[model samples]
Target: MDRVIIAGGGWSGCAAAVQAKKEGADVTLLERTDMLLGTGLVGGIMRNNGRFTAAEEMIAMGGGELFQVIEENLKHKHISFPGHEHGDLYDIGKISGAVFRFLKEMGIHIYTKSRVLHAQMKDRRMINVTDAEGNCYSGDGFVDATGTAGPMNNCSKYGNGCAMCILRCPSFGGRVSLTSLAGVQEKMGRRPGGAVGSMSGSCKLYKESLSLEIQERLGRDGVAVVPVPPELVEDHLEKKSCQQYALPEFRENLVLLDTGHGKLMTPYFPLEKLQKIPGFENARYEDPYAGGKGNSMRYFAMAPRDNTLNVEGVDNLYCAGEKSGLLVGHTEAIVTGVLAGHNCVRRIQGKQQIILPDTLAIGDIISYVKQEMDTPEGMERKYTFSGSFYFQRMKEKGLYTTDTALIQKRVEEAGFSRYFSHSGKKDCVS
Candidate 1:
C-alpha cells in the first residue's frame, strides 16, 4: 500500500497507475485536462508494424489491461494503411472513457483538471507535488508521464502557432515537467535540421465533413487513399514527430483512417488545399481546430532516465512516455509506464528493480533509446515501434514479429511472466 503519485494522466500515466496498483501501491493519477489520454485522445492507431509485437510482448508479461481495453473498443482491426500493416484503430470517441473507467475499477484514484505546478523536494527525493489549486499530494514514489507535448510557448516558438491539438494546453495550463521541477536537467528532442521540437503527426477530421465517396471507403475498408494533386501536395514530412508516417506515399496521397473520426495521416494540411482534393471539398479538422496551419509541438521536455525509467539524479521519481525519451506512440508510453510503475513500487519496498532484457523489443528499445540519446545525432530522431528508424532497427535486430506465440516465448524466457502481478499489501498509505 505504498503511495505512488503519477503526474500527467496520458496513456503512460494510466498504464503506470494500473501496474503500480497491481504491485500493491495506492495510486493517484493527476491529469491537467478533464479527460484521460492527453495526446492519445486524438490518436487511435495501434498494433501497427512493430507495435503488434510490442503489444503482444506486454500482454505476455501480464501488463495488458490497457491493450485489452483498446482491443475491446477497436473500430477496425488488422487493416493496412500507407507504411503500416495489421493496424487497429480504436474508437477515439470511446477510448478515453473506457480507459478512465478501467483505472477507477482497479482502485486507482484519478483527479482530472489537477495540474501539478510545483514539487516539494527533500535532498534527492520528492516529498510532495502541489497542484494548481495548492492541494499537496505526497507519495513514497512518483512517476512523470507528463509527456513532452507543449505549453503554447514551445509550440509558437518551435512550429507554427498553436493548432489547438487534443492536449488543450490553452484550457488546462501547459504541461509542467515533474523532473524539471525536481531540479533534474531535461532534454529536448529535435528535428533533423535541429529545430527545438517536432510537430504532432496526423490530425483528426470530422467524419461528416468529408464527402460520401471517401466516407464510404473509410467505413468499408477502414482506410481511404486518395491521390493528392501534384500542385496541392505540401511536404512537411521531416518536421513530423511521428517519422514512421513520413513517406512518399503519405505526401502523394491523402491517407485517411476510420477512427470514429477521420485520421488524416499528415501532421496538418492546409484547409484551402484540402478542400481542392476530390471528396474532401468540405473537409474540416475535428481535433486541432486549426489543422490547416499546424498541429501540437512535442518532445519539448524529456527527462533523463535509466533503463528502469528512474529519473537520473532523483531518488524517488521515475519517468515514462515522452518524458522517458523521444519515444512516441501509445504502446511505447504504456510499456515504459508499466515498467516505471512496477519499478517505482519495488524501489519503495527496498527491492531491486527489474529491467526487461534486450531479448524482447520493449526492453531493447528502452535500453537502446537511452544509449542513443547520449549522442547528438540520436536527439534529432524520434523513436516508435510503429515505424521510423526504430522500426527499421527492430527488423535488423529480428525484434519485429507478428507472431504472438514467439513474443510470448521471449517474454517467458526473460522471467517476466506475470511480473507486474505480484501482490503483497501493507497499507503504507495510512
Candidate 2:
C-alpha cells in the first residue's frame, strides 16, 4: 500500500486522510495540538447560503462523509440568521471528538501533538517529515493541511498580541508548515487595507455567562440577535477574515449562535461594553479567553499549488484548506482536502490526477481562488461559499442551488459521481 503522510490534523487533514484511506492508501495524520479540528474546534457554522449547495455537491460526489459526521452532531439545523439561511450549527464541544473517532475508525493513523518540524527532500519530492520529538514519518506522498492560523509570532506581529485563540500555539509550540519545511515558497494573505493577515472573525462566549433570556433564545431558536448600543459598536469589519459576516447588521447587533458555546459573530468585543448590554450583562468569552481584545490571526502561510492541488515544483506534495488558498469555512476545507487526498493516491498510482470540472462549485472555487491569489486585490479578499464575494459569484454563475436532485445530476454529468469512493488497491508507481 502507498503510505500518505498528512501534516496538520485540522478538518482538511482529516478529510484528506479519510479520502486517501478510501483509495486504499495507508494514511497518517499529524497535529500539533493534543486535539484535532484546528480552527474548526471553535467554528460550527455549516450549510449556510451557497455552502448548502457545495455540501450537497460533495455528497453527490461521494466525498461527504465528513459533512455527514457534522450533520449527525448538529446542535441546530435549518436555522436562519442575518445574512445566512438554512444553516447548521454543529456542537463544537462534540464535533472534534466525533471526527477523531470517525478518522480512527477509517483506519487512518492519527498522531496528536506531532508537529512536523522538518522535511527530508530528494530533488523536489519529500522523502520524510520529522516531528517535534524527532520521530520521523516516511511516505510516498504528502498533504500539507497545516492551516494559516498562527504560531503566536504572526499573531503578535500582524494582530493584537495573542488573544489566546483555540489554536493554543503557546502550549503546542505553534503551527509548523510542511510546505515551508519542503522549501516551497508560501504566500501570506492580506487584509482589505493591505494588512499582512486577518483576525479570526468570531469568538466563543460561555453560554451560562449570558442572561437567562438570551440563553433561552439561543437554546430555543439556535440564534439570538441582541441589539448593540450605537456608542458601543466597534468597527473591525475590514480586519475580519470571514468577510461574509462583515455587514452593517453585524456591526449594529450582537449576533450569537448556539454552537455548544455562544458563537459571537464578530472578531472581538470589549468585555466592558458587552457587559453593558441587557442580555449580555455577564457574558464572557470561552475560547480566546481574551476575546475582549482580539482573536487569532489567519492566512499567514498558504502553499502555492495548481488547480489539481499539487504543490508547485514538488513531485509528491499536495495542499488543502487555508494552505491551498484563502478559503474559509469547514465545507471549503473538506472539499479541497478530499481532492488533495484523492490526488495524492492518484500520483502514487501513476494515474492522471483529477481536476474537478468548473461545472461544480467545488471545482470552480479551487480554480477561481488560485487565479485570484495571483493578483493584489484577490489576495485581500477571503473566499467562502457562504456569502460575500464568492457567494455572489456563485449566484452569478448559477452555481448555487438547493435542488438536491439537480446537484446529483450535475455531479453525474461532470463524471464525478462517487469519484472519491474508490476502494481498489493499485501497485505503487515507483
Per-prediction tally of clashes: 0, 0
Residue runs of model 2 more than 4 Å from their true location after superposition: 423-430
TM-score, candidate 2, is: 0.98
TM-score (all chains, Cα) for each model: 0.98, 0.98
Q: Judged by lDDT against the true structure, how good is candidate 2?
A: 0.92
User: Cα RMSD (Å) between model 2 and the true structure?
Assistant: 2.0
* lDDT of every model, 2 decimals: 0.91, 0.92
Query: What are the runs in model 1 whose C-alpha is more than 4 Å off?
Result: 423-430
* Tens digit of per-residue lDDT, candidate 2, span 212-331: 998899999999998988999889888999999999999999999999999999999989999998988888899899999998999989999998899998989999999999999999
